[model samples]
Target: MAGLPVALAAAGALAYGTAFGLFGEDARTTAGAAAPAWAEEAADGFASVDALGQKGTYGGRGGPVVTVRTLADLEKYATAPGPHVIVVAGAIPVNPVGKEIKVASDKTIIGSGTSGHIVGGGFFLGPGVHNVIIRNLTIRDTYQGVWNDKDHDFDAVQMDGAHHVWIDHNDLRHMADGLIDSRKDTSYVTVSWNRLGNNNKTFGIGWTENTTADLTIHHNWFRETEQRNPSTDNAAHAHLYNNYLQDDPGTAVTSAYGNYARGRTAMVLENSYFQGLTNPVIKDATASLVQRGNVFSGTRGRNESGGTGFDPRRFYPYTLDAAADVPAIVTAGAGPRSALGTPRAAATRTLTVAKDGSGQFTSVQKAVDAVPAGNSSRVVIQVKPGTYREAVKVPSNKPHVTLQGMGASRKDTVLVEGRASGTPRPDGSGTYGTGGSATLAVEADDFQARNLTVANDFDEARNQHLTGHQAVALRTAADRVLLDALIISGDQDTLLLDTAAKDRPGRVRLTNSYVIGNVDFVFGRATAVIDRSVLTLKKRWDGTSAGYVTAPSTPAGRKGFLITRSTVNGDVTAGSFFLGRPWHAGGDATLDPQTTVRDSVLSAAVRPAPWTDMGGFSWKDDRFAEYRNTGPGAGPAGADRPHLTDAQAADQEIADWLGDWTPAAG
Candidate 1:
């Protein structure tokens, strides 16, 4: 017909595609396991190749992430400038039917679990658009009730003159026209692990005059479709392998053909299974086509091949699934999976907490106490809108726990406590230290907190007699911790982003949130990514003492804190704040503290020389640097101020910080 296409549950690794580099291309699907890195997907095939001076198809990896539910918000972000990782939460109907939303360059539009659907509409990519990925979505219901009637041009995804695009793991059907229409010399594209069926004019590649398109179509199941089967024309390199194309009974007439190569297109078709199809493979006399190791079943008309097509291995490396296992692999592993949005492979159990005796527990801590110890599955402690003046802790044994607030704003549901660092413990164990004074301390892995406020209201101004005023609002020493839309407030040492030990891997991602403090408010040894958030530099309790923002004591050869696309400002004097200083924890010279403030706005509070020595460790001896900072406080790098070059900043990205792990909402 028309067109063709974390376990981290994380096991059963099926081998295929590019199984190298930071991203693994193995397919894994089992109960409580993931279907590859669905939450952290990057391009793999021809789209992953660097061409036209663009570095592969990594859509919105360096940009902020946004979640949209309505059609207007979806359209607003899809056509916006720069890049974004947009999560579609539910079905967005395309009004008046057959309407196509024009998506701009550098966007990753993925589904939130299996609920993201574009109803009666599709997406369109205009000329010169590049680096776009549309994955794990159901784009359907655009049928005009007239398949043979060719009046509407409503396609599931139509791209013209676009480059470096990847369409994967989606359910696209019931379209008015071709399911995927790639025209006007679109190149460096990959279509993998998609199910295309129940229509005519399935896939059409190339309606342009130039032979510039490079496509990799693999592991796609084209079922119950009539024709096209991705008819390629004037393609420079069209590599089709391990594709399962099966035509239902009838509809395979003289005019219907599968895998048509026309107009001098160089095509390589191999290891594909074709069942119950007429004219399974055909090529024009002038085209360069090569066919080998293809399995054909039932009936087929013309499976002809001639001329020597160009080899694809010279361009990029890719592995293929066996032709016999194509049916089993594509059918079971295709479409929008439920585990794509979830971090765990098993079903998540939920527990609610409210203050006024309306929930399962009276306080947030009580709900956390109710969780079964050493639990294997995810447990969500939903907190209602209330201010619970108590401490909350998730121990190391209690992993996969999320404390989500069921409130309209993050300010509504508050988990607060008043414990200064020097406050003596009731158990006579001495004072609660800076790390132990945290109102909310998460020591478990796979932790998440959203739409909540964690504050250590220790009254630093009232406690002028105290010596230690380090009040921590939140301290997390774990892996894969995501804090979204939260407000962490205190005076000094507010948020401690740490690791279990010097050898363990501890990573945290904080986005669309706020962290307010003065002295080393956001400090730790973890590889933390503070993205698109606000880091307000508050005045000290005396209202004149200037403080630092971050004090990282990262281990040697390990990454530290990364604050990107965020704003650093507060109600303080000009040049009163340093970006960060190296903190050699426990006077350990082996710890190399580092902090990078990149693509962020620094108000008048930040000093020109934003880094310095701490605990006898020189900042220059470590990895402290800045890149592309703006606003009044930003300046060029000197001997005292380190700045990262363009090439250097490219290497230190979010992907480099959080390796194979992609943080998701619990």
Candidate 2:
């Protein structure tokens, strides 16, 4: 209980023994009939809390039990009247004619064991369908569908205008669109203890112009899903608690009204765990949220609300979970699988790359190209001790990839390339842009690099006569990316976080890393956090009197960059380096750049009057601030540097910056 809120801690302890205390007193119901042994266990596991679908009431209460083994058999019983219990056994493959299976009212579909599977089709709950229970099965390889012409809508389970539905303990993945979706007046739904992965869109709640969705999403494991871990549009009331989200590209919970009539969306998010995600909660100007006891570690994103405000207690009367206990609790019991079981061996495929003929591959690019297209599981590429000269790219289709280097230090295994903004392509096209000039470019989600050095060896003195001197060492456009114990070195524009064309902005986390450059080396528009790292500014080669450190082009209403508990050291002359400047792309007046540097040491290499102008844009007009910084280069009072007050610092915490997602590192 390290960071637990006192009120939530007391409540969790009080509800430890009583079964009905967990769900609140309003959810009690009478036991109607005797249930099967397996069904009883499922009820006991989920009934700790009481809600609309508690005690399996959504399923058949008094009807006879019907066991199903084939797709045709299941389809035959789906339309039967009266409360019925339908148990599924063995594999059921759906037809390929774009047919959807429709379910009726008062039905229960339970898988007999772990061997139950539903392939190539999905379940639909719409119109008069009500009181349904689906549990203990695997739904995979559903037809890929489209939504709004641009968004993916492939779904393993879709509910529309339904009530009292409970979907629990199922593994869903590999769909063309979303894994689960509930929209258009769907109410009283509980989704728990399920595993969702390997899909573009994971979950979606509230669609079109309707705003009457009452949902509870708890104890679910979302792994490696790209976006919309449920995009909530004008949802009336949504309670998301105690869920585990890992390696998500976009926002974990999106509450916004895009191109729709403005309405209110009230949300309560508590005791959730986020690891390697971009933003946990992104709300529009019309949305309202109340967050409490949430832990975010090693995550980056904005959690603050930009719209209205409301008290969450008015919507529901429930006990909160302690934030400090969320990681252990979620890790132990969140997914359909239990963490208490025996540890399994690593399932990821490992390949070795050596410059000599000792390994399977000689070049790093060749190893990256060898990855199977649209692979689901993680593939680890281990590079032996050698310097490889190449430009590597991990495409968007190839996700869940890791690049590990066998080196004592980051300097031991290196990837070197030379390409600046002025460098032209082999064809007679324009030169490589700032992003295209990176030595190592990553476009896939869930990408990780450990113990490596990526360098752009552009000759600054020789390229002084060139038009654009920006040479990037790393350009990452994907979300949920991590860089650990790495060295990024170049002269200008060394590291670039490019999300300019993405639907949602990407996020990055850098821990124990070193970045060296002279002008705008660490820059971009993505939401990034640098912890226990170093930013060094080298001397300028053009014989200029001063240089700039950062040039952020952050969009309005978004967090751009944060450097906490780090050190800024440089080899330049005293008072020669400015902290940062602003970049206005296409002279967009709506863009507002933001950056913060707190609790760090600034060397004398930093100028006293930091933050200069760039592209005819004044740095003072942007959002830049410093807090609790000390050293020789700390700018004086009344300088251009704005100081953050204690109250403002409290509001600008890293936890609030990340919302419900807790980062792994501070």
What is the C-alpha local distance difference test score of each model?
Answer: 0.82, 0.68
What TM-score, over all chains together, does every model reach? 0.57, 0.50
Model 2 bad stretches (over 4 Å): 1-346, 500-503, 542-545, 636-639, 659-666
Compute the lDDT for candidate 2.
Answer: 0.68
Off by over 4 Å in 1: 1-345
> How well is each residue in 1-666 modelled by candidate 2, as lDDT tens digits?
111112222221211110000000111222343444444332322222345544433476456666666677778777777766666554566786234578888877765444345766778889657778777656776534432224435468888887778788788877766788887877767788788876666788777576766677777777767677767777776777777777733644332211111246777666877766666666767777767666776676665544343454554455556766665665555433211111122368988899986988999889999999898767888998888888898898887677887876666688888888998877969898787889999999767787787888877677767778898999988876767777788888989976736347677777677787888888888778776777877766665646777888888888888888777876568888888888776787677877788888999988877788888898889988888888998865565778887546644544334321222210
For candidate 1, the per-residue lDDT at 504 reads: 92
Candidate 2 clashes: the total is 14
Q: Which prediction has the highest lDDT against the true structure?
A: 1
